[model samples]
Target: MKHLLYLFMLALPVVATAQKDSLAGAVQATRPLPLYRPGFALMLSAGSTGGGVAVGYSVSRSVAVRVGANLFNYDGTLKSGKDTDDIQIGFDYTVKLKNADLMVDLYPFKRSGFRLTGGAYYNINTVTFFGKPTKDVKFNDTVFTIDEVGTLDGKANFNKVAPYVGLGFGNPYTRKRLKFMVDIGFFYQQSPLVTFRTTGMLEPSSDQGSVIQKNLEPLKYYPVVNLGLSYKL
Candidate 1:
């Protein structure tokens, strides 16, 4: 009987220690992981605005700031059929999309990837066009050569400062070191301003810049669709 009592006392501390250790582990497992910490990240992206790079800083779990720049360029030719004046034309054009941005991101949900973003862009977008007769044409019943029909050279520019709004998925400051992100938004660049000059018989066409401007009114809002990869620094 004395040996039995000694055995129970001897086992009590070991049993209690095991229970305490198990309870500590359970508490640790139930504790939530940290979702946000102050940090910096570098991001690379591509979208309608073009290819871009940015640096971002997390101010908190709910807020972040970023600065970035984007650029894209295209050159192509377009052919047009008879105009109102019955003139067929072909144009060689170049498009430039260049911009820098300052943006803020807001996360409304504590454990969500969704975010709202707002920002301003320093825009330097422009289009240059050179148009000429595609074939021998007539003016006032007089047949004229392509050279005599002349050419129109012009450039279209947009507002320098643009405001943007967007929503996106992914949070770079999360526990993961790397993340995938997507953004969909629009920026207001206002109407395009066109300036042009004409040579030879097409000199009068220079006055038609307003017609070009009016036609481009619908382009005031530029759409953005960006896909990106971000790495926490």
Candidate 2:
């Protein structure tokens, strides 16, 4: 992918000159030029945020738009320090994520290949985390099975909507029926809400989920890097 990006970047200057020559020829003729804008494309994107497919449209040489969805998930074990009785507590869990967005891409230079993009999205990116105790938990001096101590779970949600900003290669409105592009950017979201708690067994009276919320505060923003192939229609 890296090599492909390098090759694409190297070819842009040549492409611009060739395209410019074609435009000059078109202008020299008496006939009216054919409409060359308003093309559509199918695109794929991938990064830390996840992977997704999108359908895009070029409204003009400098303006384009697209929409798509993506998914991501992870799992692991977690632990905390021993309680006063010297008993350790741990849990095994999984987290699933989802996101969607509507984006507009803008190319500032009249002939350069770079694109500046920004848009608002009905962002549904969020985390669903759930876990079961790793072993018996001791409470009030009594050791109990993880079953007796209950399972812990929660949904961590970010803002339903967010703004996105990114830069990319290939005009959002590529002239070729097939072209490649690269983009790196992020979504600015608000602090996540981790409403985790124990369920269906020995429930602790204290609000222990606060610690988890504090730990998750840093994930308020989502970063993305994408490589794509688009076919104009």
Cand. 1 Cα-lDDT: 0.91
User: Model 1: how far is 47 from its true place, Å?
Assistant: 0.9
Which one wins on TM-score?
Answer: 1
Model 2 lDDT tens row, 127-166: 6665665667666888888677667767777788888898
TM value for model 2: 0.70
lDDT of 1 by residue, 1-233 (tens): 99999999999999999999999999998887568756999999998989999999999889999999999998998876656556787999998999999999999997888999999999999989999998887768989999998999899999999999999999998877789999999999999989989999889777788887886677789999999999998
Model 2 stretches with alpha carbons more than 4 Å out: 1-38, 81-87, 137-144, 199-202
User: TM-score for each prediction?
Assistant: 0.83, 0.70
What local lDDT score does residue 223 receive in model 2, on the 0 to 100 scale?
71
Backbone clash pairs for candidate 2 read none
Q: What is the lDDT of residue 138 in candidate 1?
A: 72
Worst window of 10 by summed lDDT in candidate 2 = 82-91
